[model samples]
Target: RLFAEKITGTRRDRPELARLLDHLRSGDVVTVTRLDRLARSTCDLLDIAEQIQAAGAGLRSLAEPWADTTSPAGRMVLTVFAGIAEFERSLIIDRTRSGRQAAKAKGVKFGPPPTLTPEQITHARALVDQEGRTVKEAAALLGVHRSTLYRAFNKQEPTP
Candidate 1:
């Protein structure tokens, strides 16, 4: 009997589940207390069910009778659920993309703030270019890594 009770249902890296699937043979039935106990999401559930079917094994959920993959009707229901899940995921992706675009239009930044300001970058560049100070020395004066100073220098336009 494979048990993954300690692992959270949201995690996909259950060792016991992997072992059970790996050892499954033809005509084997993998019984679970519930469908949620076996998979994190509908997509994950369908993927595991597909693997079981491919191995000629079936899945049966004690709490969800309709989840049995050994019967024709059960297979049909799961297939329909898979289609719905796919459609829902696509809709979510589209909505997220639209929302991100809207946020960008409003001048909302997504990632972390810049490490150094334009003034600091200009000062660092002047120390390196005009004073002939080493990149390392300039970065040390600016209280930043040489690479950070270098990145700042690269991003700004070269002085005429």
Candidate 2:
């Protein structure tokens, strides 16, 4: 049996998992302590399990007590649990949507703050115009990137 015991915060990145995954073959059984230990996100959990199943292996969560791909009953139970998890995720999404709507009604804009100030923009433009530096060089002097300079100049062109 593949024993997946609880991993601590220190091991959350799980550098060793790739090695285990690379070695796992068809008809192999992967056992883990719990679903939470299996994945930090529901989507990730499903993705990992899908990868295992695609390899012709099965996953068993010891803590879940019913997650077994080896038998029909186990598969049925897992399906029900997956449905429940999906429903829960949907509910969260709906609530988030409503909350965002309410926030938008209040004129709340959610996202990162603007990186450059008006003064910085004017300075960058002045430097580019006065200095013999190219756009890339100007961006380098300003500690930004060429893409940033292009955006500031409104020179967006579709890249192939």
Candidate 3:
């Protein structure tokens, strides 16, 4: 039986791939034209390979002959490659974290801009604190949710 995925290899939820894996019997070899056609990343490839192995089936890639799980040498090579891929992914994560930290130190703000300006927040607080208006009324006047106004008030430091 042959299985082909119509969706991009980047997605792991391919119906054909699932059906193929489910139908696999012992001694069955699942073949792909290339390793990239099977998975988006090395981790994804390893995960799929593990699934195939668990189902008592073998995986083979024509473009990457060393990726075959049928032979001991091929299995060893795949394991080594998986290790390297994991290390590379960790390095990438570390670099990304460092970049974000550096950006933060430079005063770069992340996430959506504040819903209300400082003046609007102050006015809202006054409406609730000084004018004795209800939080819901103030929020309605400001065109924001009551919870948003509450959070804004909670975040502000007390005035001396």
Candidate 4:
């Protein structure tokens, strides 16, 4: 049984997964604890299963209890489930993309708004003019990073 590196948190062993794939032969079986443990997403699960089948190996999901490809019923169920999983993944991707597009159309900011408010920018720039303090001194007084002050007032906005 081959476990994914992402779960174990030891990424240097990914090449070991490649080696396991290379060593597969006919009638070999790969087992997993659970479907999600084997793969975080449906696309990832289907992709790994396809790779195993291509290498002349079969997959057995312990939690699924009926995914063994050696049996006729198991093979039938696998074909149907693989199709279902792929469809489910595509649906999720489409939904996520649509949601993001809708948010953008509504003018909802994708990330945090400008770190400093417009009022703060004016005050900071004034301090820079009146007292001749360094940007870092004004930023320290404002309780923000020096880079935040620079990004808010010193840097020019990009032109469309």
Candidate 5:
């Protein structure tokens, strides 16, 4: 039986992979094009291997001779690769988090900038509240959308 999943291997619950696991039987060999295609993490790979073994089945990787779970040496090599994959994943996560922290420390802001300036918002609020100008009129005069002006005006309100 052949099962295919387009989901990333890093995800824990890939539907096709789960189906394949469920359908596995004794002596069945689950084959993949590559070890990376099967799992992105060592723990996940090891867990899947254990599950296959429990089902009296084995796993094979077409690209990696060392990924044959039916042989002792292949299992050992796969174990080593799993450790390396986990270490590599940890290093990548650390680098990404550090880069984000550095960017934040440097005052780098994410997402779109405010649509209206502080002065423009103050003027819009005054036109709407003090002069009793409609939101549409204030927004048209300030060259902004009525919804944008409305949101800004609501946020700027003083508590009673």
Candidate 6:
């Protein structure tokens, strides 16, 4: 019986798998129960296969007959699919960037709006510093978090 090492972790973040791959030698076959169990995505799958091939090793999926990296046809098919997946990801990124640019051109702001306006912040700072009010008191009057009020005050203060 062949002793198979059981590695546990998300396929995307398996340090053990990476170490195993690095130590794999020629004639070594890395076998997995399933294709998805080994790779998080098709691109990741192809990259791992390329690494194995570069190291003179092969990959085999028990559940996926077509995912055999030991065969030329399987390698070609996997490479083609990975290329398609990468192209799709690039298209998605381009569309998202263009969309964000269009929104920016129309004065759309990203992230949460400020909890308190600049004038409110200034007043809050005055209450805490000039009026000798506690940070908690000033924050309560401004209807903001104490940390938020403190952050605004810190930004307005000049270092001694």
RMSD of 5: 5.6
Better of 4 and 6 by lDDT: 6
Against the true structure, candidate 6 has what lDDT? 0.80
Candidate 4 structure lDDT: 0.76
Sort all candidates by lDDT, best to worst: 1, 3, 5, 6, 4, 2
Clashing pairs in 4: none
- The CA-based lDDT of model 3 is what? 0.90
Residues 6-92 of candidate 6: C-alpha lDDT, one tens digit per residue: 654343567667787878999888888887777777777777788888999888899988888889988887888888989988999
* Model 4 spans with C-alpha error above 4 angstroms: 1-27, 32-41, 47-57, 61-66, 69-87, 154-160
Point out the higher-scoring one by TM-score: 1 or 5: 1
**lDDT at residue 75 of model 2 (Cα atoms):** 70
List where candidate 6 sits over 4 angstroms from the true fold.
1-11, 111-160
| Model 1 regions more than 4 Å off | 2-4
The C-alpha TM-scores of every prediction are 0.87, 0.61, 0.88, 0.54, 0.54, 0.61
Which one wins by lDDT: 3 or 5? 3
The weakest ten consecutive residues by lDDT in model 5 span: 151-160
What is each predicted model's overall lDDT from 0 to 1?
0.90, 0.73, 0.90, 0.76, 0.85, 0.80
What is the model-wide C-alpha lDDT for candidate 2? Answer: 0.73
How do the residues 2-103 of candidate 4 rate in per-residue lDDT, one tens digit apiece?
Answer: 535443422334555666678788789987777666554566666777888888888887888887766778778878977898788799899999999999
Off by over 4 Å in 3: none
**Alpha-carbon RMSD to native, per candidate:** 1.9, 5.6, 1.8, 6.1, 5.6, 5.4
Per-residue alpha-carbon lDDT of candidate 2 for residues 1-160, written as tens digits (9 for 90 to 100): 2434345523456655655677779989888877777777766676677778788888887888777776778778767767888999899999999999999999998997756666666677767777756888878877888887778666433223
Model 1: per-residue Cα lDDT over 1-160, one tens digit each? 6656577878867877888888999999999988988889899999999999999999999999998889998899999999999999999999999999999999999998998999998888888889999999998998889999888889999876
* Model 5, span 58-132: residue lDDT tens: 999999887898889987887787688788989999999999999999999978998898888888777877899
Cα-based lDDT at residue 7, candidate 2: 56
